[model samples]
Target: MALLNKYVGITTSDGQSHDGFIAHVDQDYITLAIPTNEMYGQMNGMPAREATYRQFGFFPGFFPRRRFFPRRIPFGAVTGLFLLPFFI
Candidate 1:
């Protein structure tokens, strides 16, 4: 769709707003690539040691590194979608 690959803010039916890049859009859902810092703030406690290590590349992987956490939002729950001016 028009929003694919763009940074965006999404407001869901529950009134929660999520900011991320629109990675994929299909008939049923939109997948957003949420920043790691944003995902950390949403979590309940400090990240586990292993998770931190993985995030910071203490361990190696064959695939390319990922900087975002992928989240799929249902189309029916999306109330608003707009561009977000994010500075990295």
Candidate 2:
């Protein structure tokens, strides 16, 4: 639970990959704070907001939650866990 709200990468058995904050976690599932992608902006007809692509660090994944929310991945489906250094 220490990794809650911290950045992480999850790869599930279905070959899906995600990179975002650990929005929620439990024995049953893990939720990632998903950022809407470029198409989301164009689809919503919202003007592109200036991106703080480096808010936490130089890497794009560091502070990625923009127009964010949680996405749940069942723990049973998780094939790998890639935790960020600070969380350790």
Top model number, TM-score: 1
Question: What local lDDT score does residue 23 receive in model 2, on the 0 to 100 scale?
Answer: 80
lDDT of 1 by residue, 1-88 (tens): 7778899999999999999999998889999999763223222333455457566544323224347988999999999989988776
In model 1, how large is the Cα lDDT of residue 51?
A: 58
Q: What is the lDDT, from 0 to 100, of the residue 61 in candidate 2?
A: 32
What stretches of model 2 exceed 4 Å from their correct place?
37-66, 84-88
Per residue, candidate 2 scores C-alpha lDDT tens digits across 1-88 of 7778887888989899987888877889898987665333222322234353344343333333357767899999989888754343
Residue 29 shift from truth in candidate 1, angstroms: 0.1
Q: Which candidate is the best by lDDT?
A: 1
- Give every collision pair in model 1: none
Q: What is the C-alpha RMSD of each candidate to the true structure, in Å?
A: 7.3, 8.9
Name model 1 segments beyond 4 Å from true. Answer: 38-66
